[model samples]
Target: MNTTHRTIVSRRARPAKEPLSQEVIVKQAFLLLREEGISGLTMRKVAKTLDTGASSLYVYVKDLQELSSYVLDYALASVKLPDSDSEEWKNNLFAALISYQQVLYKDPGVAELALTTMPLGPHSLALSEYLLKQLAASGMQAASAAWGLDLLLMHVTSSAFEHVSWAKNEKRSFTLMKEAYLSADASQFPFIHSHKNELFSGDASNNERFLWGMEVILQGILKQDQ
Candidate 1:
């Protein structure tokens, strides 16, 4: 009468993990950048987010800087380039560059990376090629198009990078800057005194400033074409 009883155990199958590669690592790094921003994208942090060891990340990237750089390149892949006609090419190019700036602004660390790093990754190269093509079609000569890439990127990245830095600094004190302007011996600085409201008008209106700059550059480009 020693009838036996059996116990059944149930288990849920786990999902297969994505295979690890440089691309995979960079993808995770991008998520970290979006979540915690540039400073939060340390190697250890990214590793933890990816559920892997910090050492494992080295298999893909050389170091934390390289990892951040990789994240920039990875993010760049999302930028879609259109192949519209050269007609209205100046405006088309302006719109494209604006898209590029918006992409960097959305991802804080990227503008600095784009500015400092050479065009290496696939997306960066594609962007460069697209800009060059558009510039040529927009009536830029060989030299103008060649330097135009540098000019456009330099201006956009510098502006975007400064804004990113300003954004991240919780202790950012514009008080002194504003004070200086206000105190600028109004006798000599008639314009600053008169336009104080316009000058100190805060961050919410940056789009106008950005547009003004792009418009000036576009005007210069148009004159070159002429």
Candidate 2:
């Protein structure tokens, strides 16, 4: 009967668990990159997003440069090269480049990060190796294939940065540019004004511009093969 007089107490609340490893932290950083862009990415911000102390991140990532490399590698790791057996190596290369561009454009911040950092991780190396192998298979010399891969990747990253920049600061009116061109003295700038339609085509889509560059590079490679 005396046991009825006592009441049980509730257990104390448990503290939140820390991330299992740097892998989870890096994953969260990428999530932040996707949502907020590069400008919004910072150690403090990523820590907050991941619900951890910023100092803890330093143990896994030395600095923004390292973190940036990790993020770029993580993003690019998902891009699978096209089939190597197709014999249309040029087309496959072009398609792989397109896939790469799509991934970069999807996360504009990663595209910007890519411009500053060279590929140093396993994922980046794998991508370069795949492309180089594809190019060599397509009749390109090793040196030529290496250089071409470099040039193509540079163009893609830079182009993506340019597009992101333009999108962020697109206040300049295409209409105003056209009007000024139309009102200019034809004899003074005839060619410039004559191509106004083509010039002021209101921004090219990343896919279209990427495909165009791919075609140009592929053609050049074909010429070299001859």
Candidate 3:
């Protein structure tokens, strides 16, 4: 009888796994989010990715909601904020908001988290501070600045979510919807039938439309101050 020979490798020779911490766990969660959107961001999957049990993750993150807030704030670190003393505060603010939208667009999971979780993480705080400072520079009162910040962030986050949802949907679905809009009865839906081209002029993912909306919101806020 012939027997196959096997060589056993020692585990000691293998590289050591990276030490687990809140930072490591959050990073792994973000990676999973990027790969599989919001559905992939689960404590079980994060622990699995880290080669640990779900119970071990609870030692660092209290629950999935906390993990989501951490991941969302971590992703917001990529947003580009302008220098404090920039002359074009309005332009810089718009640019910052645009950057914020782009950051959410990077990962749909983060966009979903932005809508659901109130992230108090360092990066999230930084974003809030930057927006408030810029709004103040624009002559907005404390109330307007606070409320406007909420509106601005909401618009950007919702826009990202809508764009991501559309991307996830079938193109045929959008085509059918567009066809329905185009085929609306002129007598019953005069505005929709007449302004069909104008209604469908721009894409949700387009920065021009996004910028226009930002401008409108800022103008409205400044107007309220006046």
The global C-alpha lDDT for each of the candidates, from Candidate 1 onward, is 0.76, 0.76, 0.88
Candidate 3: 10-residue stretch with minimal lDDT:
199-208
Show where candidate 2 strays beyond 4 Å. 1-12, 168-185, 200-206, 221-226
Q: What's the distance in Å from true for residue 179, model 1?
A: 3.5
Q: After superposition, how far is residue 93 of candidate 2 from its true place, in Å?
A: 0.1
Q: Could you tally the backbone clashes for each prediction?
A: 0, 0, 0
In candidate 2, what are the lDDT values of residues 1-226, reduced to their tens digit? 4666766655545465665476887788788888888876788998887777889899988887788788888888877788776488777777777777777777888888889876447788878877887788877677678778877888778877877766666537644656887677778989976886666553365466567776787668667756
Whole-model lDDT, candidate 2? 0.76
Candidate 3 per-residue lDDT, tens place, 73-166, comes to: 8998999998876467787788788899888877887888888888858999998998888888887799999999999999999988887778
Residue 100 miss distance in model 1 (angstroms):
1.2
- What is candidate 1's CA lDDT for residue 174? 62
What is the Å distance of residue 20 in model 3 from its true position?
1.2
Q: By descending lDDT, how would the candidates be arranged?
A: 3, 2, 1
Question: Candidate 3: what lDDT?
Answer: 0.88
TM-score list, all predictions:
0.77, 0.80, 0.93
